[model samples]
Target: MPEATADRTVRIRLVDRTGRQVTDAEVTWDRLIRMRAEEHLPGHTARLAAVSGAGSATRP
Candidate 1:
């Protein structure tokens, strides 16, 4: 049997203090795009999100 690959889709949500969805900073946006495109691994995605202050990455 072939080995199965993990799903790389990560849902990222950014909201301001007013509870309104907002765009991420350049750094965060770059990371987000890369993550969403599956360019980064799950661990890397979570770390990037934390460092960029974008949000948390959870497994579902």
Candidate 2:
């Protein structure tokens, strides 16, 4: 059987105070979306599980 994998591609733009690129640091859209979801969402465990695909969204 072949293993399953989820697509984790994310594109984002980041700049410093001078509007210059920061080396060794790349912002990901998925991470930012997950952070915002965690901050505004109510339930803690549910939200975390949803983001990490462990509880309900997990692949069987």
Candidate 3:
């Protein structure tokens, strides 16, 4: 039987005060993107989302 490969995806939500979605800083964005799209890190995807002072998490 052929080997099977599995992929993992991570999603995060960031929140700010007053219940409003906010954008991440450039540095943070780069880090998050790298974690998801690294050459050595295959079969995995990472996504980041910012919410109103509340963070969300996703598991794969």
Output the number of the lDDT-best candidate.
1
Candidate 1's TM-score: 0.26
Residue clash pairs of candidate 2: none
lDDT of 3: 0.43
Task: Compose the digit string of candidate 3's lDDT tens values, residues 1-60.
Answer: 112212333345545557676643333444556655773245322222232222545532
Question: lDDT of candidate 2?
Answer: 0.55
Error of 1 at 30 (Å): 29
- Tens-digit lDDT track of model 2 for 1-60: 112211344455655669897544434555556655775455666767778888554377
Please give the RMSD to the true structure for each candidate, in Å.
13.5, 13.5, 14.7
Clashes of 2: 0
Ten-residue region with minimum lDDT total, candidate 2? 1-10
By summed lDDT, the worst window of 10 consecutive residues in model 1 runs over: 1-10
What is residue 5's positional error in candidate 2, in angstroms? 14
> Using Cα atoms with residue i matched to residue i, what is each candidate's TM-score against the true structure?
0.26, 0.28, 0.23
